[model samples]
Target: MTTLAVPAARFHPLRDSATMLRRNLRRMVRYPSMTLMLVAMPVVFLLLFVYVFGGTLGAGIGGSAAGRAEYANYVAPAIILMTVTATVQGTAISIAMDLTEGIIARFRTMHIARVSVLTGHVVGSVLQAVFSLAIVIGFAVLVGFRPTAGLGGWLAASGFLVVVTFALVWLAVALGQVSKTVETASNLPMPLMMLPFLGSGFVPTDSMPTVLRWFAEYQPFTPIIETLRGLLTDRPLGNEPWIALGWCAVIALGGYLWSRKLFAREDDR
Candidate 1:
């Protein structure tokens, strides 16, 4: 029995995680509206900015000749980042629902790997984020946004976005576990969605007031957006990419530790 138990424990982790991932994917399909709503917000913002506000903003950034086209190129990175935040917001909501609905309790009693439950959500959210990004980028292109990134740039940008998504998804998982209710989980990540607006996303940080500009320049999202922008537009990145990765590492580690603690507490309860 001891020999059997050791081998089962070793083998079950991957299998259990795969099973949980499938469960999450099925849940996503079962509830299509949530996915649509999550994807729609970023698309709406992209359209609103590029069409409604792009011309004036474009002139401010470059000149009147650049117009909406230039602004679309400039704002596309921010919109992409927003897409990731929106998708992870959904992850928090989903996690909260699982906890509140007693599915977690049921999972606790099962022989499955405990960590697999959270990993399922994390992997599923990342996939959803990637899908949403593709749709948003396609829309951006349709609206006159052009990126000059070569194959390597595109690959690097894709990898960077994945890392960002992974970090944010872990953070969302922790936020979800910390919430007492689904509504609270939904609200907790609200600040994340707002960060892009407050950072260098919509306009240059230089244009902000003294204090606001300082905050915008130092915030995690600013460097992240700038790194992505540099990759996509073939602009010189300087140090923003490293700063962005450092931020991601911090957030990911904090979130992972918090999540494990929370899950253990739940088990104790």
Candidate 2:
């Protein structure tokens, strides 16, 4: 009997990552509504804020009028980013869901590359992230929010955000694996997604209460907000971009290690 050992290098730079993503893309095209609903969830939240709570909340932000443009001006990016945060956990849930139902056993019995399964989810979420950003941006444009920074700036902001999303997907994967139920996966992203609310997101941290201000000014969200705002308004680059990247990297590695730990415990590493 001969056994072929797979090198660990197989996963780095994600050689199988695109292949996994392409497969999901085909699935997404086949199940358009499923993807649309996923894309729509954040838009639903946007609508809630825009119509139901926007008028009053606008004053809380910069004054009145939280349209898809002005209000979304501050929020649309975060809202789009939230889609990644929200869906990345789905990968972990996918793993755990399959595990709980013995579907994982079925996959393993077929000798699929364990990495491929996880990669598939990450890649799919990336596509979802792009679609989410496009939908939010399209709504923002329709509402009169023009990117004063021009196409290059818009693309730059989008690219940075995609990096942020890339980092977050891994965190979600970890959480989904760590969680016990699918419901937990669905609920866990809410808090982390809301972290930006307390930071320099909707309003400047300077306007916040003294003690509360300190925390909001320093958390990961602060940097992310500053980076996005600077890019959109053509303001000076703040330290937020670096800080945001650092935060993302830390969270991603931690979650990746955590997911690996969980994976190993189930007789696969």
Candidate 3:
């Protein structure tokens, strides 16, 4: 008697990831209160800075209506950056919640691709970040933030935002994996949220003291913020875009590798 050969089922990580992503996206739609809160926080920051502190900050930048306009223009980029950082907090918490709630264990036992689970979170978070950025920028425009850049500039600015969002989301993923609880995950990325303030996001680097000025000039967020400002306002980019791209590369790679290692460790546990 002749034996027949059997064909094994093919595994498609991308297809699996897309399916998982749809599940997460559906969850986001079903529970939008968190998204609303995340979106609102950036708008509040925009209002607080432009109205509450705009007078003093505007005068510092210049001295007339032009000064106010200048301040609005300068701060818009920072607030957009803040929007991205703020939205990623939910990503971390959601991932941590899943892990702690045994969702990952359930996924592991299923006959699906493993990496797809994390990929779903990353994609969902990045999309959320972009939505938050758009809302914050719209609020900024209403408050007198104007960009002098044309189509090319807008495109470049968008590209930079996408890059930074991806980098930050990856980092958030790693943070989520390391945290033992959702609360801890929510707080772990606080420093990432605060980095803009410590950098030249609100003021000129020269305005800061020596040590802070140095740090403000060199920190990862500064270059990214400056690149964004330059793209939006027709200012000289200098080397900021390159530096910001380098930082994005480093963050994305490090976060991806670390998250994968931690995720793999789940099996060992």
Could you tell me every candidate's TM-score relative to the true structure? Answer: 0.96, 0.81, 0.97
How far residue 39's Cα lies from its native spot in candidate 1, in Å, is: 0.6
lDDT of each: 0.95, 0.70, 0.90
Q: Which stretches of candidate 2 lie over 4 Å from their true place?
A: 1-23, 51-70
Clash tally for model 3: 0
Best first by lDDT, ranked = 1, 3, 2
* Model 2 TM-score on a 0 to 1 scale: 0.81
Error of 1 at 106 (Å): 0.2
* Model 3 lowest lDDT segment of ten: 61-70
Candidates 2 and 3, the one with greater lDDT: 3
* Top-TM-score candidate index: 3
What's model 3's lDDT at 130? 78
Off by over 4 Å in 1: 1-11
Evaluated with lDDT, which candidate comes out highest?
A: 1
Q: Model 2, range 87-184, lDDT digits (tens) per residue?
A: 66555555567567776566556535667666777778777778767777686566545667988888888888788777788778777777788888
Q: Per-residue lDDT for 191 in model 1?
A: 96
Candidate 1 lDDT over 1-269, as tens digits, reads: 35554544453888999999999999888988888899899999999999999999999998767788999999999999999999999999999999999999999999889999999999999998988899999999999889999999999999999999999999999999999999999999999999999998999999999999999999999999999999999999999999999999999999999999999999998
